[model samples]
Target: MFHPQQEQGQPSCRQNTEETDTDSDESEYNKAPDAPLTPHNMQTMLRKATTDIKSHLASELDKRLSGIKEDIESLTSRTNHMEARIKELTTSSQAHSQDSTYLHAKIEAMEESLEDLNNRSQRNNIQIRGLPEAVTMEGLHNVLKGLFKSILPEASAQDLLLYRAHRALRPQGHNGPPAFLRN
Candidate 1:
């Protein structure tokens, strides 16, 4: 039998009963007032909560891990640069050390050459001792000429050449005897 409300496009008593039954069934499964707390419902809720937490934790861990990976890469790059710099410095230091050694050897050779030259130049020089400090340059020249004539009487005046003659430098009252340098 068709009702008047059903003919006017409104819900009839049978449709209302079916709608209420569907709503009550849905509310039983998804927490509702007067719905009994069954183990199945609790398990379903716990599974959903765990799934959400797992997804959140996974996302957080991924973000943190990506950041850590970037930091590690940056540190690795810096370490590589530092290692390269250290290598460069070590190479430069080794080169400088070699140069320093070469220069030191060259300097020693030059010093020996200078000492040999000095010895050769001073070989012809002579030192005259026991000479009075008050002897003048003219007096020293005359005395040396007379002594050379006596020592080599056959030698001419040209062979007896006196380059320079000077008194030894010292205090007025020193313990040492007087001396003269003849060159």
Candidate 2:
């Protein structure tokens, strides 16, 4: 065959070039002929690399799973704490409600007792209206004593005793005279 590497007037030495290329290629492999790449070696390297990759992936997965587990445990603990707090608050609120109810009932009872005591204190007391402003305390007392004596002749002086006689604290109006209270 006509070769491109040959000079136009020179003959092609194809056989000699082929022999040189073969010798150089053999010299390179002759140095380590026992360690030549083969299917068995490639299969062993592939298996080792696959096992290493699997081990790495498993380790990463374990780390992530442990971290997730820790996070779940932390969340569970917080949830439990919150539940306990809610229960405590509920109990406290119930107790406070009971206390408020008790206080309200006691206050109402005290108010009723106060009203009853006021009515009882004023039951026997007398209010004399239309009394003239000119009536003195001593004069009103004497008039009441005489009136009581006339009304109850069998009563003793001690029974007709007047505790106090006084006029109303309000200013006298033009429509009516001042009133007196005798107790």
Q: Pick the candidate with the highest TM-score.
A: 1
Error of 1 at 164 (Å): 2.9
Superposition error at 7 for model 2 (Å): 39
State model 1's lDDT. 0.73
Q: In angstroms, how far off is 65's CA in candidate 1?
A: 1.3
Mark the regions of model 1 whose C-alpha exceeds 4 Å error after superposition: 1-35, 136-155, 172-183
lDDT of 2 at 19: 47
Q: Which stretch of 10 consecutive residues in model 1 shows the poorest summed lDDT?
A: 174-183
TM-scores for the candidates: 0.68, 0.51
Q: State, as a TM-score between 0 and 1, how close model 1 is to the true structure.
A: 0.68
